[model samples]
Target chain A: MEPQNAREKRDAAVEARVHLIVFRLGEEEYGVRIDQVKEVTITPEITRMPKTPSFIKGVSNIRGDIIAIMDLEERFNITSAARDSRHTYTLVMEAKDYTMGFIVKEVPQSLSLPLSSLDKAPSFVQDFNISENFIEGIGKYENRLIIVLDIFKILTSDEIMELKS
Target chain B: MKSREQEYKEIFVAEALEYYDALSRHISELEKTPEDEQILAEIFRLLHNLKANAKAIGYLVIADVSHKLETAFGMIRNKELSFSDEVVTVLFDGIDMLGELISNVDGAKEIEPSPALLRNLDIIINTQTDNNTELNKVQKYYTSKNLSLSDLIYIQIKKLDHLLNLVGELIIDRDRIVSISKELDNDDLKNVSAHLYRITEELQYSVMDARLVNVGSLFNKFPRIVRDIAVAEKKEINLEISGQDIQIDRNILQIITDSLLHLMRNAISHGIEKADVRKKNKKTPQGNIELSAQNDRDTVILRLKDDGKGIDQQEVRKAIVQKGFLNADAVSDLRDTEVLSFLFEPGFSLAKEVTEVSGRGVGLDVVKNAIDSIGGRIKVDSKKGVGTTFTLYLPTSIAVKGALLCQVEENFYAIPLMHTDSVLSLPTEKLHEVGNLLVTDIKGETITVVHMRELFNNDLDTYNGTKTALEGDVQNIIIVTYNNRKLGLIVDKLLRQQDIVIKSLSRPVNTIDIYAGVTLLGSGKVCLVLDVAAITRYFIARR
Candidate 1:
């Protein structure tokens, strides 16, 4: 009975797959857990909010609710390619009790890969000045490498509130 | 699935909190009329049930405290003992300790009642000769099963908050559709949209109304708080509360609860004089504190008045001068009311000696901040020989705010009507400079006027000395007030006055205090609501 149970556990582990919504920031591809992305739509008109950091592009009206729109490239300190604003999309994300949107130039695509395809990120990724907390791992599917992002870690729960003080 | 033990603990905690509130209310009422047998019996019954409930949950400490308390009440019911000051103090301590134990039952380790508290209860129990078996029999007859039953369900407040948010979204959509129907000028669409609008409006109000709890739910707890402070200070304070049936949004009540408690303690400690002092002043020996609420137009006024020695303006002025807040010459020029307003300044205390209850260097400024955060205003009025009264003007509901939409340059902003006093256009010549500050005179009062263009342009930088050139010959100024101070916010034009559902700016944008929150305009554009309190404070601090 023990051997049979162990075999079943191994089979279940092999069947585990991680589904991610892949989007582009600058030249690099980033993937966030599919469940974290609530919806993706064309970028709406954003009203500039004064006194906020540059990364916070502004607040926008999304389906009658005001959501703060953040420039993902600016947040990650990546030099923007200065893409046309009309062609960009806003990814509405649910992050830790808060709903926010991120602006991306390219449309996001969903992909599901087996657990075996995910691996620990290389140390050089940290050298780019992105906190290791923001990276879930590296996903290698086919010949392309996708940087699995931990959406919840991009903004710490108390980070914004702490700045207010 | 939650374990049975976990489920039981949750139920126990919720029921225990309700019992605590009910018990506190009953105990305070009992103190007021010690001979009222009905209230006494009710208290005894509640204690008995609490004891049983605690014991069944294995909260030995809570059960033991409740059992002793129940026994004392039972003896009191049998005419075995009288309600003396000592008995009152011990009874209050037991109830307070029980509250602490019940609240901590969810902790990793159980909290044991202090030895002294247990000893006090033991002394009270030992004073009785009989075990009161007859009273015990009567209590057993009136068991939990015999109590009146109500068909009610407990809801998590978080769910109500979410529903309120969804309702807010529907209201916004209803407005959007109504506007679209008007633009299209389609008869059938307009008719259908009109019907939809009414339904959405009714739904909006119903959802908000569900959250409107009686102010009494909050005001009832105060009798005990006042009792505790009155007993400790040895002052005879008769807290007369009325208009408790008036309802308010529970969220607003929660925000202002601590501020009200702080104000109450201040009244008992600082405002009210000693009994002998009152007698010397040709006043009744018992001080009176009237805490009443009344409805105003779209606002609720909570008034806390005390018939005690009113604020001594002379002492306040002296303190102001001594503290170097202002020189004697300038302080003397200020009016009596102006000097009194300084009582809310940070670290400003007139208490010669720090007492256990208050005067720990935390002044009314913290209370002012709390009120300010809720977009409410507080004003203090006192007549030196008569009394002191604090009138707080608060909005009826926080879900939607009445705001004046104004345009600054090209951006649209909404200033809450609660803070907005009036709007008028002033010619450029009316604006003058007092020293280095821009001051505009309106009705003999000089209010500092800062152009919104400059104020919003500087990111987190408060009013700088740089004076921007006025563009137009006429400047439209919106008079905004916070606390007792007022400022004139110069805007380009006033769009319209409308009810706006304020949506809090999440994350990074929330750190910006100048804007309270963002709201969606009827045109589907996001508009920021100006934080009048923050702007007024910044303007005042710069002066």
Candidate 2:
């Protein structure tokens, strides 16, 4: 009975674990599934595009394709009282059809959390006025709360097009 | 692999559409000159070939229609029946039916010709219903030699587009390797690179050549379209088309076909005045529209000129103010060219009443966009009472472009050399501010100038390490011309011209109008290709 219970616990843990890449935007940490992140590289020189929103940092050359780069902090309107240092890393993300990059202030780390540890974002999220559906849930790791993001939702063509206009 | 039936159906549809086009053209010509033996023989031959091919493919409806049409033409050839209004009407109806049925051939549904059409044709030819006799006659005339397979084969254009894209990537990599070999200065590597470059050049040429189609294939169809539009509008338009053998990228022809048709419709309905009005204006009662294409160096120049009522600047200005798009003061300040450009603006119709052909106000803008999509430029020239001409300059190919690289501040931008007229150096002080526009005299021709530094400096505060290009005493001005309008753009430095492969920007970023597409340099840095035509149009509209 003891061996069977141990095996069941191991199976549950294996099935429930969620791998994510955590990056910092302002003071809060955000996590997206590792599957959604194509690659992480030290931020490259981004060419600024004219007549686009401020959040759209510009485009970067990735394997001969121009991938649009975005400033996640500005995109989500996260305010940090202290001025953050220069963006040190760019996270390449795979959306439905194309790949894009998001610039964050620090190099992101990969970590796993049990699926059970994720809680639906608090109702007060409505008061914060962040874009609706941008976050999948809030994740609780040992002592930190990570805002789990829905990358596909954030990269929805309709919302991006809206931001364009 | 396709089924044998499917393959035959494809052949049948292609041949049927060709036959329909030929018949329509000949029937229209026969209306004007009823005694042209050459046209008469051509029509009969096309119908005969179409009937045999369609019958073999089991497309019985098309075969039946072609057979009846062929019988009528045979009677005409035998001098038993002559050209009549009824004969022309029945032949046109038959051609239209063939086109309609051929388009729906993919569906495995049975098709039957309209009884009225068959009845009308029967009355013309007085044919007896003798299917076996007709089949024997067709078998005799259509020899086995006619059915022998040809060397030519049909290739799906999508496959060609995919191949072209792959070739574009290979060219980019080839360029990169060439640059790296040059930097290393290794003799063997340099030789190998040169050979590779030559081979890639030939391969690129062959791929591009495979996609070349005679412009006549597209131009031949326009006469029929023009005839239909003229008949609907009760207008007499003499469409003079030339340069039929000029070759262009097949995709470019496909992209511009509809836009050309739209222009033709606009010319007939709006640009051309009524017969009575033309007589009163002392112009020819029969309006003339010349559609011609010619090869211009590395580009194709297509001109559509109409001797119709040109755009009235005063009327456009009045409409601008009346529509409240701009206040009267602003409209008054606009130059005549600027006022004329409003005609291309969406929903900026000058027509007093919406006509079926045009003036629903959604045509010229779409036409402009189609031209832009193919990396082409279109310009309209009008002389009020004289006429209007829309001249389109299109790149011979889209995968590769000849671009002149220039630097502004710390970034690099490529200006398509086709649109670029000349590069000049001038003192910064030569730029004079004329009512909010910087105008400079270039050999006594006043040219509006804009500094690249300020034009692309919208996000200055958000980014760092960007400086204005006007720090020195002299400025590098590249004069770009679109239509007859020219603009002098000042840059910091000029770089060597290169053959760049342009990769279109994916979503969100593609909406930016200032940059056409981005190309990677030898140093792995991506440079934006400036949309010179759009920039010129913007400045022209500004003035």
Question: For residues A65-152, what per-residue lDDT tens digits would candidate 1 score against the true structure?
Answer: 6788889898788876666655789999987777889998888899998888999887887777567778989999998789998888
How does each model score on lDDT?
0.82, 0.80
Model 1 error, position A133 (Å): 5.5
Could you tell me which 10 consecutive residues in candidate 2 chain B have the lowest summed lDDT? B135-144
Stretches > 4 Å off in candidate 2: A1-6, A26-28, A73-87, A105-107, A124-133, A142-145, A157-159, B1-47, B50-150, B273-285, B309-340, B443-446, B459-469, B533-543
- Give the Å shift of residue B516 in candidate 1: 2.4
Per-prediction tally of clashes: 0, 0
Candidate 2 has which clashing residue pairs, if any? none
Candidate 2 residue A54 Cα shift, in angstroms, is: 4.2
On the 0 to 100 scale, the lDDT of residue B392 in model 2 is 83
Could you tell me every candidate's TM-score relative to the true structure?
0.72, 0.74
What is candidate 2's lDDT per residue for B344-453, written digit by digit as tens?
66677767777777667675888878987887878888888788998888888878889899998678899888778899889878877776567888886778887777
- Per residue, candidate 1 scores C-alpha lDDT tens digits across B127-174 of 766433221111111112222222235778799899989988887888
- Please state the CAPRI-style docking class of candidate 1: acceptable
Question: After TM-score superposition, what is the CA distance of residue B151 in candidate 1 from its true location, in Å?
Answer: 7.6
> Which segments of model 1 are wrong by more than 4 Å?
A1-22, A27-35, A82-85, A109-121, A124-149, A157-165, B1-162, B213-228, B238-241, B321-335, B434-437, B465-467
